[model samples]
Target chain A: MARLVVLGGGVAGHTAATFAAKWLGKEHEVVVVTPNSKWNWIPSNIWVGVGQMKKEEVVFELAPVYKKAGVIYKQAKAVSLNPEGKDTSDKPFVTIEYTQEGKVGESEDVEYDYLINATGPKLNFDATPGLGDGSGQMGTNTVSVCTAEHAVHASHELEKCIQKMKDGERQKILVGTGHGTCTCQGAAFEYIFNVEHELKKAGVRDMADIKWISNESFLGDFGMGGLHMKVGGYVVSSKIFAESLYAERNVEWLIGAHTSKVEEGKIEYELLDGTTGEETFDFAMLLPPFSGVGLKAYAKDGSDITESIFAPNGFMKVDANYDAGAYENWKASDWPKTYQSPAYKNIFAAGIAFAPPHLMSKPMQSPNGTPINPTPPRTGMPSGIIGKAVAHTVCDLITQGEGAHLHEASMAEMGAACVASAGKGLFTGTAAAMTVYPVVPDYDKYPGTGRDTKYTFGEVGLAGHWIKHVLHHMFLYKAKLKPGWALIPE
Target chain B: MSIEEENFQKNDNFKLTMLPGAFAKRMRTCVVWQFIRFMVLNIKMLIVVSKSH
Candidate 1:
């Protein structure tokens, strides 16, 4: 029987492993290797960061779920990949170091017939100065909601700031892009608003000065450029919507900024227009840039095929047209259809682990040659879609045969629904529920915005917030492998 | 519905704003015309103010 090995157990990896195990059944083995024993619903970690949710509320033990799914689960981190196996065999094997129980640091090589590398992102906080200390954890200075544990810590720090504010001490709050090339601006944007919401709820908003700083040339440019949203029966660009939101909320902003360094209580920043400045803050929630988990690969001859296996940014190279240069020249066809790696037919990448052909923004560089543009973001909807698509392709190759036709799901052809909460409320709060067709722009189909304007609109009200709250629980329930879980989309 | 329809339904009073580049050349001609008018007005104003002085 062929063995299908999946790496990491994030949204993409878990979806791939669960679907592959169900489809392949007992005929083929499905193995999942991840460093964490608990699966975290990362989106809810934002709530955790704001003290609105508990850590346990967002994370659950993965062992029982994997057991129920009939998939072998190994709590280990993949060290490296030998796509060409060892000198003795042509079969591919992955080397993993265990992180569970007493077998910590113990290594093993698991052979695989097909592999899905949905390892997600490395949370490369160390890429920026003082962000981290190279241990894959956030630094002691600033806080992040990237993980549940980090969110918990950030919440604690926030509580301390709140207490200080209660004692009549004014606190300066800064939130947004930590690095110039950071992609997940949406998360940061959500976080800043959440913090604002929480502070206002605590009655200490008057004592806090909250500000946003980002690499986006304009506000609301959530990686896929700014989209036009139909709000209140009026078609307005996200730029205008975001501007109005910031103005109405009294949250000041500085766009086109590149955070250069982080010191105690302050951060050094440079703007796209070549101006340098420093912002001091009592509390900061800066989102770090993401990178591949730094997993290396070697060829049969031991020659480093690292370049062949991965993009320059360390994300796995898939079937995308990497040479599709220039923003104006980019087409929807540039995205990969099958997600199969060009180097190895049996290997595939999904979610943030897959290297996008190009940035989504109108590629712009600073006068000093600093490439300051929003990196292509493969957020929740796209990550789950790609994961399921990869699973389908893998199952077809295993069950039907090697020549089985692969399924196609391009980011440029799919639609994504995002519910961004302005504040949590039943009837008193607000959220922006937006739907954008083809998360990536398809210039050939929709010339100007590259999005179907009809499908791309946002409505802000109490109902939108309710949708976000429901999505949080629904996604977690699906991740837990509970009853009727299959009914949920990947 | 098409994007135009969705947009129109969302905001009945909203006017479509074209990209700045599309009318840049035409806008330059208008700017020249406005500049001549401003110059003539200023010259006339100067003459009136000088006579009053």
Candidate 2:
């Protein structure tokens, strides 16, 4: 029987493993190697950071779910990949170090006929000084909600700040981009609003000042560039909607900013116009830049193919046009339809593990020649979709023989729906529920904004807030592998 | 007040003035007549502009 091994158990890895197991059935073997023992619904980590939810509510143990699926689960991290196996064989084997129970740091080699590398991004907090402790933990100077543990820590810090405000002390709250080249501005956007909501709920909003800082050239450009949304009968861009929301909430903003350094209670920043300034805050939540998790690959002869297997930024290289230079020259066709690696035919990558062709926005550089642009973001929906597609291709190859037809699902041809919460309440609340068709811009099919106006729309009201709350529970239910789990999308 | 005196008061900055009950009734009728006259004039002007165009 052919063996298939999936690495990392994030959204991409979990989807690949479960789907591959079901499709291949008991005939083929499926093994999942990941470092974490629990699966987390990362989107709802925003509420946890604001003390609205607990860590346990956002994460659940993976053992029971894997047991139900009849799949082998290894609580271990992959160290290296031998794609050409040894000098003796053509089969590939992966080296992993267990991190479970009393077998922590134990190594093993798992042979596979096909491999899917859905290992998500590494949180590179060291890219900025005073941002992280250099050991994958947030530094004392600032707080982040990227993981469940980080959210819990941030919630405690936020509680302290709220108590200080209630004692009649004025507090300054700064939230946004930590570095110039950071992505995931949407998460920070949700967090800043959540913090505002919590402070108002604590009855000390007037005593605290809220401000936003980001590297986006314009507000509402959430990495995939600015999109048009229909509100009422009028068509308007997200820039206008986001600006109005910020104004209505009385939250001040600074765009096109590069946060250079973080000191105690203060952060030094440089604007796109070459002006430098400092902002002091009683509390802050800044997202660190993302990079590959640093997995190495070698040939059978021990020649290093790390460069060939990965992009310069550390994400795996897929079937994309790396030479698609400049923003004006980029096309929808440049995106990868099939996620097979160029070097190894059996190797595939999905989610944040795969390298995108280029940045969604026009590339900008600071006066000191440091490149600053929002990195392309592959959110939960797209990550799961790509994982299922990759699983289908792998299953076909194993069952239908080597030259079978592969599956195709390009990000440029898919649509995405995002609901961002401004506040959580039934009567006095607001949120922006936005749906954009063709997540990647297709200039030839639709001009100007490169999105279809008919299916693209956004509305900010209490109903939108309810939808966000419902999605949090719905996604967690799906991840738990509960009854009727097959009805849920990957 | 006489018609000449009433016209002087209406044209002044003081927007309101007291009058006898019978005189107030007559003033309301005159105001309605003046409004109808103004609307007819505007309609004639609009028709002239449209014809020219």
Candidate 3:
């Protein structure tokens, strides 16, 4: 029987493992290796950060669910890939280090017929000084809601700041990217607004000064060069929508900023204009830049093959047009349709683990020659979709034999729905529920914005708020492998 | 800040493109008006999605 080993167990890895197990079932072996013990519904981490939701509500033990799904779940972090096996054996195997209780730091080599690298990102906190404790862990200078634990910490910090505000203290709140090359401007957008919402609810709105700082060239470039949303009958640009939203909410912004360094209550930043400045805040939640989880790959003779298997950023190289050149020349075709590795046919990558051909936004470099651009966003809906598609291709190859057709899911051909929460409440809350057909801009197919305007829609109101809340529950339930879980769309 | 704005936006080869105002009027609100209008829009979207596949 063919053995399939999947690395990482985020949205991408979990989806791939479960689906492959179900499809292959008892005939082929499916193993999932992830460092985390719990599966987190990451989108709801915003609510958790604001104390709107409990950490338990967003996470569930992954082991039990994998057990029910008939997939071998290993609580371990992948260390290296021996895609060409060793001099002792011709069989390909992966080196994994256990992160679970008791077996922590222990290593093992497991053989695999096929490997799916969905190990996600390492949350490169070291990319900037003071973002991390100089050793890849988040520092105390700022709080983050990128992880469930980080969200819990952020929630407590936010509470303390609110208390200070209520006690006659005028607190400055800064929220956005921790570094220039960071992505997920959307999360920070949702977060800053949610903080505003929470402050208003706490009756300390007037006491707190909430400000946004981001790496986006424009206000609304949520990475994919800022999409145009069809609001009501008008095809309004997201820039105008975001600008008006910020103005209405009294939220001031500094765009095109690369936060260079962080210290207690202060941060030094470089703007796109080559100007340097500093901002101080009582509470800051900045997203650090992302990099590959640093998995090394070696050949049969133990020669380093990491350069051939991975990009400089350490993300696995898939079937993508890496030589797409400049922003003006970038095409949607540069995105991977079948996430197969060009070097090893037995390996594939999906989600954040895969190296995108290039940044979705126009790449920019500061006058000092430091590149400060928003990286491509691969989260939630897109990650799960890519994961499932990769799983489908892998299962077909394993079950139906070598000549079977591979399933393809291209970012250029798929649509994504994002419900960015501004607040979390039944009737009082609101979110911008946006739908973009084909996340990647297809300049050849649609020209201008490279999007089909008819299908790209967005609206903000209580309905969106309710929908986001519903999605939180639904996705968590699906992740838990509840009855009728497979019916839920990625 | 001013220089940063000039640096980022000023060098753009194409002028900033704005969307048509036909659908703009319906966008600006959050209370009862937005609630009713957006609910209808949501329903219409649900129908569109259901019909698409």
List per-model TM-scores for chain B.
0.43, 0.41, 0.45
- Native interface contacts retained, candidate 3: 0.04
Model 1 residue A411 lDDT score:
87
**Each prediction's DockQ against the real complex:** 0.01, 0.01, 0.10
Candidate 1 local lDDT, A84-126, one digit each (tens): 9889998999999999999999999999999999889988888
| Displacement of the residue A57 alpha carbon in candidate 2, Å | 0.8
Best by DockQ: 3
Tell me the tens digit of each residue's lDDT in model 3 across A1-490.
Answer: 9999999899999999988998899988999999999999999999999999999999999989999998898899999999989998999999999999999999999999999999999999888899899989999999999999999999999999999998999999999999999999889999999999999999999898888999999988888888888876788888887875676566778888999999999999999989999999999999999999999999999899999999999999999999988778899999998899999988999889999999888898789987888999988788888899899999999888888787787787777777788777676777778888778888899887778888787877666777787788888888888999888778
Give the clashing pairs for model 3: A233-B23, A234-B23
Error of 1 at A403 (Å): 1.4
**C-alpha lDDT of candidate 1 relative to the true structure:** 0.81
**TM-score winner among the candidates?**
3
CAPRI grade of model 1: incorrect
lDDT of 1 at A432: 62
The residue-by-residue lDDT of candidate 2 on A17-48, one tens digit each, is 98898899999998999999999999888888
State fnat for each of the candidate structures: 0.00, 0.00, 0.04
Q: If ranked by TM-score, best first, what sequence of candidates would result?
A: 3, 1, 2
Write one digit per residue (lDDT tens) for candidate 2, span B24-44.
Answer: 334323545434533433343
